[model samples]
Target: MPGSLHNWYSLSWLDMLAERQSVLSGRIELKRLARLRDMLHAHDGSVTVNLRFGKRDGAWVIVNLECEATLALLCQRCLEPMLHTVAARVELGLVESASMASRLPEDYEPVVLEGDRLMPARLIEDELIVSLPLMPKHAHTSECGSLVRRRDESTGEAWTLDCAPPTSH
Candidate 1:
């Protein structure tokens, strides 16, 4: 229901090409994709999608999708919040039937549509999550350099250096 566009394929052959080939762009609220929070940490901002769909190989469908989304992640060193952008480009095939899965090329990942409809939102979300960095670091590492305090092994007390003095004048 949330990620559905059932009527997109109902247009006449010529009209469908005219409308679907041009970029179909829209913003999907992040709240809708919150279900994947466990996989997509600190997610925020609207998920932007640009897509173009067309027929391929007579019956199969091809969808070229581009997506962008922002995520707030904790910096690994300082534990401060940092904004990270996720972008992904994917070309997917919608096979006519499940039986075609075996015949698909090694590089292609076929997505079977339930009922002649395609939901770009869900696909975009999946790609966004996959494209996210395994470890997000601060863009400005110098700002957080001072915050990297380490504890003395003996005393178990956190310590930070004020500054390293210049050796030569």
Candidate 2:
């Protein structure tokens, strides 16, 4: 059987909160996620998101986004493929424009409504990208292979730098 409209991928943020609508949950293919393109090792997994709409502080329309996924990234320390799990929950006060987003309450981040509606997939992808580490690395440097030694001219001795190569996945 076909899934109901409840499975629809996008909707009007304002309308959803006003009516206290059902949560929107879906998968976004990794290949289709643009912002995270450079970080992914193989573009092989999908991000799953569940968007729940409601009123925050009983006054403002807020969208609670829950996103989860495992992204393949090249470890900065090891320069090898590594798996990183991204799980994030964010609450945003939906607004009409960029300026309005800046004026939202301290507790609520602002997400400007681009048109009348919002694309859950796009939002999910953006949030996941934000959650990734700036420079992804293994938990321990020991996991990194041999450290290259460079000869210091002043001392005429070889020195090993602590950091490894920064690799894209």
Candidate 3:
């Protein structure tokens, strides 16, 4: 059966870290991701997140998280709505102190464990936010609607402008 997460979810950080034997898999609605509102065209669809905890190197506990979703975002090239598919994988090391967090390996991102608790839903949301492209645009130049011939001031190179100039009253 498929598992789905609710709008709110909390878990014991210490226990999950110590036991290192839990797998959380669920889907969250786009509306729940308030931080992503500015970049999205509509709040309609669900994202799936799967997190598995495991012990790494006998000292630290790690979580492997996978997130998948299709977001309706305005294309930077077209200035119109387009579907952007996101599939990201992250490894997090649960750390108790800032010092320990700084010492984490390059492969893992440090997640501070505060008060022996954590909200898994919040972490998933954070991952999704970072996963988004800095400038979201369609792949093909032909698919873009707002692409127009323009000259670059810095390089003197010509390229298609992603959007048109705003009209002033």
| Residue 12 displacement (Å), model 2 | 5.0
Model 2 over residues 1-169: C-alpha lDDT tens digits? 1222123333354566446755767777788777787768889878777778787656667778898899988888767667789888888777777877777887888877666456666677778888888898877776654333223454466644546465556
Task: Give each model a TM-score.
Answer: 0.62, 0.71, 0.73
lDDT (10s digit) by residue, model 1, range 45-137 = 687787777666555456677887787767787765677777777777766568886676645568766565555666676777777677877
- The TM-score that candidate 2 achieves is 0.71
lDDT of 1: 0.63
TM-score, cand. 1 vs. native: 0.62
Cα RMSD, each candidate? 9.7, 8.5, 7.7
Rank the candidate models, highest TM-score first: 3, 2, 1
Residue pairs that clash (backbone atoms under 3 angstroms), model 2 = 41-169
1 against 2, candidate with superior lDDT: 2
Model 1 misses residue 21 by how many Å? 3.6
Native-structure RMSD, model 3 = 7.7
Q: Point out where model 2 deviates above 4 Å.
A: 1-13, 57-59, 146-169
Best by lDDT: 3
Which of candidates 1 and 2 is the stronger one according to TM-score?
A: 2
lDDT of 2 at 145: 48
